[model samples]
Target chain A: MAFPPEHEIHRRRFGRNIGVAVTLALFIVLVFALTVVKVTRGDPMQAFDHSVRPELAAEEAE
Target chain B: MSDIRAYEQPGEAGFGDYVQLLKPRVMSLVVFTALVGLLVAPVSVHPVIAFASILFIALGAGASGALNMWWDADIDAVMRRTKSRPVPAGKVAAGEALAVGLALSGIAVVMLGLAANWLAAGLLAFTIFFYAVVYSMWLKRSTPQNIVIGGAAGAFPPMIGWACATGGISVESLLMFALIFMWTPPHFWALALFMKDDYSNAGVPMLTVTHGRKATRTHILVYTILLVPVAVGAAFTSIGGPIYLAASIALNGWFLIGAWRIWRRDEAMAEADGYATEKSVFRFSLSYLFLHFGAFLAEAALRPYGMGGW
Candidate 1:
């Protein structure tokens, strides 16, 4: 059966949106997992320090 | 009653239209990179603040997407892949998209600064400008290297996330940025190889159209090769671990193979085969980046067990 023009357009639009939404949901899950790992396991502040201030690591060591 | 009849019928805006405004596809990449940055950094933001920071970053990404849609409505009208965007499809006015983009851009930068640090906020602001002005307005139509240079704007989210955590930039975050920067060319070139007609119709000078498909394919393979060292190198950094190294090796190997497959296919064969190699490369590129970033999270998980980063 042929769908109405407006209905077909809406359907196509909805399908595209669902595709984008699923991609986004997957991304959120990935991000959350990363945040949990960092927050729970490592000192995020220290990680930041080492990340941003590498020279500082040497100075501190000295 | 007579005056009411004079008013034009307003088109209704659907939920899907709003989602289009958020540019969910682009937001996904931004969110992933930002999360990695937040996770790999040495600083720890409060959980609530972290969430808020990411939300703002996503909003900023959406704002950039909206502005891009607004400015490119002319070209987007012709391209098959983008012709159905809200503005081009007539679902949303260009003016409205512009307003939403500007408003969200301001809100995201200010809120990110309030939630995290000014450095992160500043980076978000610069990213928006780079995307909206440098890539969308200037480079897109002017050169074939649009994706090459424009990719930098897309690569900044992770660095901003890192900044939010550490309140500054670092070597590790730069390395993460470099990985995405290098990966963007091959990832986009693969799509261009198959979608050559779209760029041609849109009057956009994509590499495939400007330089030919064979050249684009060669460039894709070269970039894919370059991406390998950057991805593998990250595994040796403070954020790297056994899990990340193993995952990077396996994923990058498969990715190189996919690139090789794309490079090996002749135009006639690719057309006869329905561009299967091109399509596979495009699909794999998406998963490849996700898996690489996901590996970082896995490494982070193993850290407590002393199995991560040398």
Candidate 2:
């Protein structure tokens, strides 16, 4: 049996490509949402202090 | 150019092959130990950040696995156990594995630094380097004590996870490191005892291949004996509690018994039972690690209610 044409194969796989893109986009969105929640709901200063700033930055900010 | 062009075909690396390159089994262990490290720390981390940090740590582990596969493709090709691996089996190209490893290593380290602390990121980087370069490229092919030294690479994940939360190292994390580092030799040597032919065929100098099964068995008992103090001692640390202490005692007791049994067995008896005791010990070692780490998590879970720790 003969396979589909090369372009036909490519056209058929476009759906999968779209699926991959959508999945990737959703993951990015989820990460961004989590970051936003963490920064806003959690202690933004404490997070920033521990991860980014110098020692005792949270106390200094307080 | 035409002749060279004819030699290459588009590689058929499926998603599974990519995952195989990551060595998901090893990554799962890394993730578990790292999670324990993060959770058991005294410092509180934002839940989202904790999750992100573990994700990056797992990725760093995967990167190490991929690079190891890329570098060990030659040796892997000859070993029955690893001959069918993605790189050795011709499912994935060495260059592609290297690229993926390098890319993920960079992403995991930098993103972890942003999400957690530089110390954790630095530890993760060193883990990848130690596993990929120091262990796979150098020690693996050099000596019988390869696993003994290379075990440090595996031992660092929990320390990295602890660093993610605490932003520094502590005695507790060092004890966890010691637990894995000391446990690695006997655990692997037990398998080496069973799979001696694989190492012999591959020309890899496992303790079993280099020093013989008798010496390997003795070494297993010695390490297991040494491991007893480290495991029991962790019970007194900040991460340890009543639950952890109980788990450690039970686990180490069984582990010691298993090691002792393996030590006493002659090659004839092992061959008669098809190395049943060695196999059992090998399998038990896995649960030994899991339960020990699980105890850490249990203690962490109990701490908010004030039931954990001394």
Candidate 3:
């Protein structure tokens, strides 16, 4: 089941290229996705409105 | 002269080999789910601390990967899917992987504790132990239902991340954990169907190997069916919103169709068709989990407008 030398070389080259392309594409997609989420989601503080101190106070006062 | 082998082996290991040891692909999933957990939590952490916590979580995930590689090098050598790993390929020594894994595990847990809370650190420690000791050493070779139970290791990051932010676990975090837990069997089983020979050759007791392929297929369908309700249920949780509901409905429908198709497949037809059905289901399983979690993010985004949860 030995691959031909030339075929092996070609396969190795193809694998290397695919790995690089996939890694780069993943990086680009991650950056794009995070940026979109950040822009659309707004700030976390604004979403919750309550802080650690207030929550603690309310719990203790209860 | 023979003892001076350092002179002959002048170069240190390459970066790619180190990356391979970390199982970067698996770490990506860990990072995504943990990010979702952090984002959807009720408490707010500073941006820098949030980033640091995620980074440490990712590092901890990588450490588990390295340890798994170290421990499974023998079996990995026999399995085509894993034969090219750094340890199996001899690019990285098993001892080096163990050292790296232990070092990273300590750093990630301690740093996460400092940046976040002790609860997150404790969860991270337990996760590393679950993956390295319980899953890898005990269950993987010993049982057919390995992935079903072992999947808990992979399901912990989000809960840990949630704890990092809120300093406690909540039902929301547990729901997130459940989503991944229920999703793991069907997902891994699909791959097992396609790679049955790999497990058989390596003498690993994957479901497809211990049970017949038909039974495995039925299990996949059943798990997929069960997964839909869990996913849809999460949409009604406090962290879930309209966007998540819509996404869950659409994705779960497609996944169910795929799983049903897989269940209907006969072994002869699958073999005749080069297992196209299994391969497609396997690929879809990957996207299914990712998209479901991504929708959770979408739900979080819509939370400010009162468009999410009831």
**Number of the predicted model whose lDDT against the real structure is largest:** 2
Q: Model 3 misses residue B32 by how many Å?
A: 0.6
**Clashing pairs for predicted structure model 2, backbone only:** none
Candidate 1 lDDT over A18-51, as tens digits, reads: 8768866965775576566557754434534335
Clashes of each: 11, 0, 0
The lDDT per prediction is: 0.86, 0.90, 0.86
Candidate 2 local lDDT, B257-299, one digit each (tens): 9999999999999999999999999999999999999998988
Q: Which tens-of-lDDT digit does each residue in B177-249 have in candidate 3?
A: 9989999999999898888599999999988888799999999999999988889998888888777889889
Q: After superposition, how far is residue B181 of candidate 3 from its true place, in Å?
A: 0.5
Per-residue lDDT for B273 in model 1? 84
Instruction: Return the TM-score for each candidate structure.
Output: 0.82, 0.88, 0.82
For A1-62, candidate 2 gives per-residue lDDT tens digits of 99634543344346546655775796587479667866787554444534666645756877
User: What TM-score should be assigned to candidate 3?
Assistant: 0.82
Better of 1 and 2 by DockQ: 2
> Which one is best on TM-score?
2
TM-score of chain B of each: 0.96, 0.96, 0.96
* Residue B242 CA displacement from its true place in model 3, Å: 1.5
